[model samples]
Target: MKADRIVSVIFILIALVFWSQTFGLQYNCSIFPHLILIFLILSSAIMFAQTFFAKDIKREHLSGKDLKYIIISIAIVFVWIYMLDFLGFIVSSVICLSILTLILDQKRPMPVRTLSSVAIYTLMVLVFWFIFHKFLLVPLPTGYLI
Candidate 1:
């Protein structure tokens, strides 16, 4: 089994675990998390099967630049998760999205990136505030913002 196949299989198994936890425990499926988990499980299984049965397993190579990007992305995600508790959804999300957009945009102008980041973050804030807060009745972390 190639590394790719092994990883895909592992992810598929993990997704199954998540699905079981979501449904078996009777958690809130009103948010569609379980549906997303099912999709992940099915997609991972399909990918695993494809990789396992491929005649010519193209060796997936990770270059130094690719590794750097992966590391940075992971670091950003870590900071985003940690900051969410301290800074709440709005502030932390805006900073995270802005940094992510700046990092991901290769040739886009700074003004465009800035505008895009702000727009995305604003939409996220509205969605969280309206849908999650008002409709779903999910309590957001209050980090001195409100």
Candidate 2:
């Protein structure tokens, strides 16, 4: 199968799984996920259909280094998720976002740039936390350091 088709199928499956889980949530909590899942499924289905009609698609092989980075990125995300309960959403998000940004940037890291990135991530995380925890009245994972 083509890569696009495979990705679409995978996303469709993921959407279905999440869709099922959403039923257990209260109506207010489930609404956003339902909308997002619907978008995911529709976009993936559209991509799958386009893959069938499109010809001469170029396939690029991932290099070993690129594959290594991808694997590491996935591992980092898993670790971030695991850390959330212990570190809280804000701390975990800032740490993970900074690490991910550093990993993806190929240029030599400067002290100023690193600090700026950390500050930016911190601000972003705080904004999101405020929106969800304060404005939306949604409870986020809280731990010792929050």
What tens digits encode model 1's per-residue C-alpha lDDT throughout 33-115? Answer: 77777788788778778875778645678999888877998899899888878888777877887887788667765787689
Model 2 bad stretches (over 4 Å): 1-34
Give Cα distance to truth, residue 125, candidate 2, Å: 0.5
Q: How accurate locally, in lDDT, is each candidate?
A: 0.77, 0.93
**Candidate 2 structure lDDT:** 0.93
Q: Per-residue lDDT for 1-146 in model 2, tens only? A: 48788999999999999999988899999999999999999999999999878886667899999998899899999999999999999999999989998998899999999999999999999999999999989999997799
Off by over 4 Å in 1: 1-41, 52-60
Note the clash tally of each candidate: 0, 0
TM-score on alpha carbons, each prediction: 0.68, 0.72
Candidate 2 positional error at 133, Å: 0.8
